[model samples]
Target: MLIGYARVSTLEQNEDLQVDALKAAGCDRWYVDHASGAKASRPQLDKMFELLREGDVLVVWKLDRLGRSVQNLIELINRLHKMGVGFKSLTEQMDTTTPGGTLVFNVYASMAQFERDLIRERTNAGLRAARERGRVGGRPSKLTHDDEVMIRQLYESRTVTVRQIADRFSVSRGTIYRAIEAGGVAQTEN
Candidate 1:
């Protein structure tokens, strides 16, 4: 049995290319998801893993689409191999059933890890430079002190509902609640 897996990081991304490639590759069954690789849980990936069995072949459009990290990808592939399942990545020309293909997969995996490490290194360096320049990181405050005061006053008066308060502040109810919980607003005595 040949099972295909396709994924796109977001809904805005089109899966047509991967889907077409998988179909052309003669996939008998397939799964797909529109979810970020950073997310640990993906419904379609979970389903595909569950449905795969011994002697079955799992095909993917690309390896990165299957996993975000080299460790995770290695673990997944090793698990499948142990289960007597075969794997293939169309774009990478990787296949688990052959020795040469396995070597290629390993090399690509190492390269992927290296690429990720470089990205992290560059990001940290950039942040350090920005900090050295006296630039602050993270999001600016959504509400000013004046806004907090007004929010507290409104909440104490009980003239407007929490939802109304959130609307007036242009923030979510959860954000409003967090502000109140974090002592952003004055507390009213019961």
Candidate 2:
């Protein structure tokens, strides 16, 4: 059984072309969605998943209609393969039921992985360069050095509770604790 799935990014867009293609491909049943591929939720796509069986082949008008990205496409295809099902894309002429199709899909998967690795490497290198220039990432500290010293003094005096100190500093109890710890370390170093 060839079960088809089609999608349009907006309600204004028509899925007639996709429907016609699926019908030509001899789809036994079909589902359609009017949501963007980037969306995580698609009611019709979920419904199609429920209807798919082990021997069923999931057919789509185009590969982009099925997934938002190459990684997403590979994941969906891999899932279908694991369920003992097959996949076919009309526009790309990709069919996972054949050896040649499987090879092509594997190459696509490898390319996606290579792209991801390159992105990670570039990001790490950028961070390293920033650090070398004395630039740190993450949110700036909410409390000042004077505030930390005052928090430490108030904490050691035992005249006020940690919660009271936190309220006075407009920070969390954990922040107050860290400030006290930092002040203690600074004093020891001095």
Candidate 3:
């Protein structure tokens, strides 16, 4: 069975072109999405993945329609391969079911990996440069040490609820829980 997957970045885009192409390529059935490929969560994609079985080939109108990044593409292909399924890109004219197609796909996967490595190297170098210049990255903490200490005191003393503390600090309940876990203290004294 040739299972098709199609997508458009926004609701304004039409699926007719991709659907037509997939139908022309002999797709027996399809899953379509009206969302960005950058989004990790897609209901139709997840549904299609669950419906796929061994010997079925997953087809897409284009590579970008199926994947947003090399790492993500390779990961999905690896999963499909493990399930004894094949992958095909109509525009790229590449398939993983044949030896020649498999070679080409392998080359593509390698190039994606190389691109990913280059990105990582660049990011690391930028971080190192920032460190040398006495700068740090990452978001600033939402709560101060005193706020955490007060949170611990309030919780242990049963004076305030987790929700109350989170609201007061403008953080989530999970942050308070993590702080308590990391601090390893149940109470505090003034």
Best by TM-score: 2
Superposition TM-score, candidate 2 onto the true structure? 0.78
How accurate locally is residue 29 in candidate 1, as Cα lDDT from 0 to 100? 87
TM-score, ranked from best to worst = 2, 3, 1
Per-residue alpha-carbon lDDT of model 3 for 34-107, expressed as tens digits?
99999998889999999999999999999889887777888888899999999999999989999998999899
lDDT of 1 by residue, 1-190 (tens): 9899998989999999999999999999889999999888899999998989999999999988888778788878988989899999999889998999889877876897889899999999999999999998988879997887777777878888778989998998776776676665655432
TM-score of each: 0.60, 0.78, 0.75
| Alpha-carbon deviation at 45 in model 1, angstroms | 7.2
Q: Give a tens-digit lDDT track for model 2, residues 1-190.
A: 9999999999999999999999999998999999999987799998888778899999999999999998888989998999889999989889999999999889989999999999999999999999999999978999998898888888877788888989998999888878988777332211
Candidate 1 TM-score, true structure as reference: 0.60
Candidate 3: TM-score?
A: 0.75
| Model 2: residues with Cα > 4 Å off, grouped in runs | 141-190
Using lDDT, give the best candidate's number.
2
Question: How far off is model 2, as Cα RMSD?
Answer: 4.9
**Alpha-carbon RMSD, each predicted model:** 5.7, 4.9, 3.8
* Stretches of model 3 off by over 4 angstroms after superposition: 141-190
Count of backbone clashes, every candidate in sequence = 0, 0, 0
